[model samples]
Target: MDQRKYNIYFHTHTISGIIIAALLYVIFFAGSFAFFKDSISAWQKAETHAKIIHADYNYLIDSLSKTTNLQGRDFDFYLLNSRQGAYINMSASKDTTISKPAAIKSKSKRRGQGDGAYFLYFFANKQPTTYAEGYDMGEFLYRLHFLAPLNQIPIRLGAPFGYLLAGIVSFLFLFALITGLLLHWDKIKANFFLFRPWSKWKTVWTDMHTVLGVIGFPFQLIFAVTGVILITNFALTTPFSHFLYDGKQEQLFEDLQYNRTIEVPYSYTSLDKDFDLNAFVSKWEQQWQGSPISRIHIRNFKDQNMQVVLEAKPNPSQRFAGSGFVKQNIATGEVLASKSPVEDANYVDGVRSLIYHLHFGDFGGTALRLVFFVLGLMGCAVIISGIMIWLVARNKNNIPLYKRRFNFWASNVFLSACLAMLPVTAFTFIMLKVLPEINQAAIYRVYFYSWLILSIYLIALRNPSKVNLHTLLLSGIFCLFVPLVNGFTTGLWWWKTWSSEANGIFLIDTIFLLLGAASIMAFWKVRKQAKSFQVLLGK
Candidate 1:
C-alpha cells in the first residue's frame, strides 16, 4: 500500500477505536465473567454448603397441593440437576396479564429492596423450607455487561441511551474489524505470531494488539455481529412488522414462532383437587426422552382450564436460544403443543439459534466458556493497547504542548477506566462475600461509587500514570484476599469446595487467585514501562 492509503487506514482505525475504547473495555470485561454466570450465582449463595438431600418430585408436588390453596394463582417450579433441592415460586398476582413473576421479597430496611421471590424449597426426607430473599451477583454482572450507561446522563434515560450507544458501538466495531484486516493484509502472515517484549513499548503494544486481534478475529467478528443483531432486533422487528406484516406484530411472531404462547379458555371449577403432577411429569419425560425438565409454569393454577408449560433442557446439538417447551392441559395431562429446535426448527430458526449459541458460548460447556472468557479479555486488551499506541504516535509528532497535554490526560482517563474496573470488581466480590445478606440493590451502589471515586481520583491527580500503577497494585492485593474472605464468611474453604460436588465455588476461588497473580504482573509491567518512558524523556 502507498503511504497515503496507509495513512488513511491507520487514521481510520485509530479514530474509530478511540471513540469507543472505554465502553468496549467495560463490555468485554463484564461479559468475560458472564460466561460463568450460573457458577457465580451458586458461589454467591454458597448453595453447595447448604444441606442437600434427594427429594421425590411427586411427593413435593402432592405435599404442596394439599397444604396450600393455590386457586387462581400463577406459579413456577424450578428443579436443579446439581442438587436434590427444588423451588416453587408463587407469584403475587393471579391475573394472566401480569408478565413479571413475583420474587421473594426481602425485609431489609433499604428502600426498593426485595428478595427475588417467595419460594418453597424441598429436599428429600425433610420438611419443605422457604426463603425470603436471594443474592444476585451473577445476574447483576450479566446485566451490567450489556446495560451499562454513561454516568453523565439522567438515570431514567440511562437504559435507552445505553442500548443505543451499545448498538452504535457494535456497528462501528464491525466496521473496525473489516478495516483492520485490510490494513494488516500485507504483513498478516509475516506478523501472525510476532511478539517482542523487550522492544520499545509502543512496538510491543502494537505486536501484542495485532497478535491478539488476529488470533481472536473470528470470535471478535461473531461478538460484533451478534451484538448488533441483539441490540437492533426489536428496532428492526417493529419496522418489518409495519412494512411486511401490515403492523400485525403477532402475525410476525407467529411466522417466526419466536413468542409462541398457548392460550386456553378460563374455567370456573378448580382442578387442583384431582390434578396428578406425577403423571404429567412422566408423560413429559416419555416424550422428551433424555432431556431434563428445568422449569414448569402453571397459569391459573387450580382452575379447571389451567395450562402447564414445561421447559426442557436445551439439546446440546440444537444450539438454540432457549430450551424447548411442551404446553399441556394441567387437568388432563394432555399435550397441547410442543416446540423443540432439534426436532422442528426451520432453517431461519436454526440460524437464529446458532447465532445465540455462538454469541453466548453456551454449546460447548465449560471449556468453550473458558475460551470465550479469555478471548473477551484479550479484546479488552486490544482496545487498551490501541489507545496507548494512538497516544504514543501523537506524542511522536510535532503537536502543540497544550494539545499534547490534553492527549496525555485523555489517555490517563481511559487507562484509569480500564484499570479501575479490576479493583472495583474485586471489591464487589469481597463485599458480597463479607456481607452476604446485604440488600441486592446496595450491591449496585457499591460498584458505581467505587468506580466513580477512582475515576475522579484519576482526573484530579497530577500524575495519573503513577496512580494507575498504585491502583493496579491495590487491586492485586484485594483480588488475592478474595478467596480468604469467601472462606471466612462461608466456612467453605477452597480445598473443601474442590472435593465437594459444588466445584463452581472452587473454580471461582481459583480464578480469583490467578487474576490476582495476573494483576501483580500487570502492575510490574506498567511500572517498568513508566520508568522506561521517563528515562527516554530525560525526566
Candidate 2:
C-alpha cells in the first residue's frame, strides 16, 4: 500500500473535516434531544382530565355532521380515542365533491396553550415530500443540517454529497479509533482516567479526544453509517435492487419491505347509512388486550371499498415484529392481515426495519437510550475540543502573534454559534406559543441569519479574548434560564413532575443544568487567562 494514499485515507481535507464535524455535532446533539420530542410535547401541553370519555368515531362523525356538512365526502378520522395520549384529533375532507382525503385537524390542543400549532406552523412552510411527513421535527433538522438546503444542487446531487461525507468521516473516525487504541492499548489498566493538564496542550486534547473516541467509536461508526444509509436511499439500496432484480421496482420494494399503500376504487353512491366506530374498537381491543391502538387511518374515504388501518403500540421489545401491523376492510370490518417479524420473511425486510430501529435508538429500552444520549453529548465535546486543539497547536508553534491569535479567536466565534444554537432553538419553540402568527418559517430564516451575523461580528470585533469569554457566559446564562421560562409560561417543572415521573422533561432539565454549569466554568477560566495575557502585554 502507498503511504500517501494511507494518509489520504486517514486525514480528510481540512475544510471538509470542519464542515463534517459541525454537521455531525448538530445531528448527534439535536438527535439526542429529538429522542425525547414526545416528552417535551407532553410537558409543554399538560392535559387536564376532561369529563367526557373518549367518544367513538360514530360520535366524531356525528359531531362533524352537526358542526358542518361532512356528508357524501372523503376524510380520515385519526381516532385519538384509541391512543393513550390525552388528546384526540381528526382529519377529514369537506363535502366539496372531491374524492381525496383532506386533513381536517392535525391535533387537539390542551387548554391554556398548545405546541401543536407550533409543530403545524413549522411543517406548513417546509412542504415535506410524501415520504417525509411521518417523521418528527428532530429528524427534519438532522436532514437539514447535513443537506443544508442547497437549491443549486438536486436531491441526487445533495444526497450523494451527504453520503460521501459520512463515508469519508466513518473512515477517519475508524482510523483515529484504531491508532488511539494502539497508543493506549497497553496503558489502559494504569491510565484510564488520566488527565494531565501540565503536559503540552496537543497532548491534552489528543488524549481527551482519543479516550472518548475510543470508548464511543462503536456507536459513532454504527450511527454514522446508519445515518448515511438512511439519508442515501438510492445510492445504497438502488444498486442491489437493480443488479439482482432486473429493474422490477415492485420486486425491489417487496424485498426491502416497503409496502405500497394503494387505494381501491369503489362506488361513492351506495354507502352505509351509519358507520359503527365503537364496534370496530371493541373487536380490535378484544383481539389485542394489552396493546393500545394509537391511530386509525381510513383511506379513500368517499369510496365504499375503503380500507382502515389500526396502528397499536406493542410491547417495547416488539419493535421489529411484523405482526405488530394490522389492517382491516372498512365496510366489512374484517381483519385483512397481521404479520410479525418472527415469522419467515425476506431477509432484507428484517435488515431494513432493524436499521431504522438502531438509527433511532428505539431498539433498546431507557438504558440504551441513556447510553446513546451520553455518547452523543461526548461527541459534541469532541468537536469543540478538536477545534480548540487546532488553534492551540498553531499558537504554540514559532508563528507570528497576529496570525496565531487571530485564527484562534476566530474559531472560538464559530464554536459560540454551534454551542449557542440549541437554546436559540428552544426559545423559538417557546415563541411559537407567544406569537402564533409570526410565520415560523420566516423566524427560522432570521434565526440562522442572525447567528451567522453574530459569529462574523465576533470574529471582527477587537479585544476578542474578552468578547469570546462574554459570549460563552451569555450562552451559559441563556441555557440555564430555559427551563425556568418554560415553567413560568407553561406551569410545568421537573420537581412537580415527580408524581407522574415525566422522565423526558427531567432529562432535558438535568442536561441543561450540566451544560450551563460547565459553560460558566469554562468562561471563568477564559476570563482569568485574558487578564493574565493583558498583564504580560503591559510589561
Candidate 3:
C-alpha cells in the first residue's frame, strides 16, 4: 500500500475503534459470560438440567386451569432451554362477554389496556413463581450484551434506542475491523509471529493488539455482522418492507419467516366436547420424538374456533436444522398448516438459524461455547491493548499538554470502566449465592451499584496500570469465592455436581474455578512486580 492510503487506513481504523471501544468492551465481556447463561442460571438456582429431560405439559395446563378461567383465552408457554422450567403467559379472555378479573387488575402505568399474566413454572418442582423471582445473573449479562437495560430510558426514536445504540456500535466495529485488517495487510504474515514482552510500552501494546486482533478476526467479524443484523433487523428492513410488502412490517416478517402470524377469528360459539390437552400434546411429542417442543400458542382456548400453534427446534446433533411449526384447528382436529422441523424447513429457517446459532454459539453445545468464550475474551484483550496503544502513542512531550492530558484521562476512564467489569461480575456471582431470595431488582442493584462504586474509585486512581492491578486482584478473590459460596449455600460443590451428572450446574462452577485461578496467577505476578517497583506491566 502507498503511504497516503496507509495513513488513511490507520487513521480510520484508530478513530472508529476508539469511538466504540468502551461500549464494545462491555458487549464482548458480558456476551462472553452469557454463553453460559443457562448454566449460570442452573448453578445459581442449584437445579440440574440433566434431571429434567422433559416438561410435564399436562400438569402445567392442569395447574394453570385450576387458578384462572381457561375459556376463550389465549395462552403461550415458552419452554426454557434448560428443560427445567418454562414461562407461562395468559392473555385476557377473547370473549368480550367475559370481563377482566378484578383480582389481576392494577393501576400500573406501563401496562397495556388488556391484562396478561406472565410467570415462571418449574416443571420439575411443579411450582409457579413470578418472573421477578426467576431472574438470574445469566439473564442480566445476556441483556447487558445488547444494552437492553438501557431501554428503560424514556427516550424513543420510533424504536428502542438502546438496541439502536448497540446496532450502531456493532456496525462501527465491523468498519473498524475491516480497516484494521487492511492497515495490517502488508505485514500480516510477519505480524503473526510478532511478540515482545520486554519491549517498550507502546510497542508492547501494539504487538498485543495486532496479534490478538488477527487471531480473533473471524470470530469477531461473525459477531459484528450478526449482532447488527439480529439487533436492528426490523429497523434495517423498514425501507425494504415499504418496497416489498407495501409498508406492512408484519407482512414482511411473515413473508421472511421470522414469525408465523395466525389471525384466528373467534366463532363466539362454546365447545361441548371435552378436550384432553395432555393426550393431545402427548401425541405430538411422540410424533416428533427427538425434537423438543419449544413453544405453544393457544388462541381462543376451549372455543369452537380455537387454534393451537406448536413450534419446535430440531435436535442439532441428529442433523443441524433450523425449526418449523404446525398450526392446528382445535375443534375440527385438522392440521391447518405444517412445517416439520425434522423433515422440511424453509429457506428462511436455514438463514435465520445460521445467524442465530452463529451469533449465540449454541449450535455445537458446551465445547463450542467454551471456545467462543475464549475468543470473546481475546476480543476484550484486543480492545484493552488498543486503548493502551492509543494512550501511549500520544503520551509524548512534543504533543500539546492539553491533548496529552485528555488522552490520559480518556484512557484512564475507559480502562477503569472496562477492567472493573471483571471483578464486579465475579463479585455479583458471589453475591448471588450469599443473598437470600434473589430477584430482578436485587440483582440490578447488586451488580450496577457495585460496578459503579468500583469504577468511580478506579477512575480516581487515574492510572491505567493501577486499574489493571486492582481489577485483577479483586477479580481473583471474588471469583475464587463463587463456587465456594455456592457450595456453602446449596451444598452442590464441584465434586458433588459432577458425580451427580449435573453437568450444566457443574459447568458454571468449573468456569469460575478456572477464571479465579487465572486471575490469581496474574495478580501474583503483578504483585511481585509491585514489590520490585518495576513498570514492566505498566508497559
Candidate 4:
C-alpha cells in the first residue's frame, strides 16, 4: 500500500475538523452549564423556590383528583416529588388518563401533553419511540455544535450527518491524539509547561492547542466515541439492529417487557357516564403501597373498555424507565399489565437499555450527570482548540487568499457563536419562565432563530471591533442576571429557594454567576489584547 494513501483520510479529516471543532465548542460550553439543568429549573419555579419541603405525594394526588374530575375521563396524571424543579403538573390525556384506553389502537401512539409520558411508555413497553421535526433544548445546542442550520433537512438526511460527523471525528481525534503524542514525545520530558511568550503568535497558539489537547486527550477520545454513540444511535444502532435481528427489533425490546400483555382489539365508545375517581385513586394507592404513583394514563379514551395506566414514582438511582405504566381494565377496574418482568428478557435487551441509560445519564445520580457534563464540555474545548491550532499552523504558511478568507471567517464566526451561544441560550431558558406568553416550543424556536441569525451576521462581518467583544460581554451579563430576572418576573430566586430542598436553584445561580464572570473576563482580555496589537502596529 502506498504510504500517501493515508493522505486520503486527511481530506475528510480536514472537513471533520472544521465542522466538529465549531460544533464541539458550543456543545462543550452549553453542555457544561446544562449539568445544572435541574438546579436552574428550580431557580425558576415560584412554589419550588420557597423551601425544601417535599410535597405529600398522596395528598397532592388526592387533592388534584378532587379538584379535577378524573373519573371516566381519558387522561393520566403525574406528580413528581422532590424533583428539584417546577410546580406540580397533573397531566391528563388519553395515554395519561388512568381510567381510559389508549386512543391509538395501532402500533404507534402520540402524546397530547408533556414528552415525558411517551418516553415512559416507550421505555416501559420496551418499544422504540420516533422523533418528529422538532428540537429539545439540549439536542438543539448539540446539533448546532455540528449541523447548525443544516438541521432543516429531514430526519433521513439529518441522521446521516450525525453519523458521518461522529465516525470521522472519532478517527481524526484518535489520529490527532496519536500524532500529537508522537510529535511531542521528545519534549514530553522537559517541556510539560512550555509556554514561550517571546515566540511568534502562531507558535503560542499551536502550543496552547497542542499542550491542552495532550492533557485532555483521554477525555477527548471518550467524549468523541460516546457522544457519537449517544447522539446517532438512530443511525449507528438502527442499521445494526436490522442486520443482526433481521429487522425484527421487537426481540431487542424483550428486556424492557415488564408484565406486557398481548394487544386485544376492542370497540370504541365514550364511557364518561359515571365513575368514582376518589375511590379509584384510593384503590391505586392501596395496591402500590410502597410505590408512589406519579402518572395516570387512560388508553383508548374513546373506547368504553379502555385501560388505565398508573405509573410509579421514579427512584433516583434506577429510574431509567421514564415512568412505570400499570394498565387496568376500565370496565372491571382489574389490573392488566405493568412494567415488572412477568418473563425474563434476553441479554441484548438488558445491554440496549443499559446503553440508553448510560448515554443519557439516566441511571446515575446528580454527581454522575455532573461528570458526564464536564467530560462533554472538555470534549467541546478540545475540538475548538484543535481547530484553532490547525488554522494557526496553516496561516503560518503562504496559503491562498480564498482559503485564508474562508478560514478566517469560519474561525471567527463559529468560535464567537460557540463562545457566546451558551449565555444566549441561558437567557432563553430564563425567558421561558419569565415570559408567560412563551411556551416551550416557542422558547426553542426563538432561541434557535436568534442563534442562527446572529451566527450568520457574524460570519458576514469582516472585522472584529469593540462591538464584537461588547456583544460577548452582554451575553454573559444577561446570563448571570437570569436568576435575578426570574425573581423579579416570577418571584423565584436562589436565595429564596435556599431553605428548601430545591436548593438546586442556589447551585444554578452560582454557576451562572461564575460562567458570566468568566465570559466578562474573557471579553476584557480580548479587548485589551486587540488594543495592544493596534498600538504595536500603530493602527
The global C-alpha lDDT for each of the candidates, from Candidate 1 onward, is 0.73, 0.55, 0.84, 0.53
Off by over 4 Å in 3: 103-115, 529-539
Candidates' RMSD to native: 5.2, 7.2, 2.7, 7.9
List clashing residue pairs in candidate 2: 91-104, 92-104, 322-339, 322-340, 322-341, 323-339, 323-340
Q: In angstroms, what RMSD does candidate 4 have relative to the true structure? A: 7.9
Q: Residue-wise lDDT of candidate 2 within 418-533, one digit each (tens)?
A: 66566556554445335434332545554566567655665555333544575678667766776676677766675865555666566666666676787788888766643322
- TM-scores of all candidate predictions against the true structure: 0.83, 0.72, 0.95, 0.66
CA lDDT, candidate 3, residue 184 = 90
On lDDT, the leading prediction is: 3
Candidate 2: 10-residue stretch with minimal lDDT: 115-124
Clashing pairs in 1: 103-116, 103-117, 104-115, 104-116, 104-117, 104-118, 105-115, 106-115
User: Candidate 3 overall Cα lDDT vs. reference?
Assistant: 0.84
Instruction: Put down candidate 3 lDDT per residue, 1-539, tens digits, no spaces.
Output: 99999999899999999999999999999999999988888887888655435567777777667666767878778888876787877777778876556333322213222666677878778877776777888899999999989999988876687898899999999989999999999899988969887666677778999999998999999999999999989788999889988899888888787767768888789876877666777778778877788888888888999898888888776757667688888789899898788788767777888888889988788999999999999999999999988887888778877788888888888989999998899888888888877988999999999989999999988767678888998988888888898888889988999999988778988888898899999988876754321222222
Better of 1 and 4 by TM-score: 1
Better of 3 and 4 by lDDT: 3
Worst 10 residues of 4 by lDDT: 530-539
Q: What is the lDDT of residue 473 in candidate 2?
A: 80
lDDT (0-100) at residue 86 of candidate 3?
79
lDDT of 4 by residue, 436-503 (tens): 55433565677877777766666555444433575667767777777777677766566665655556
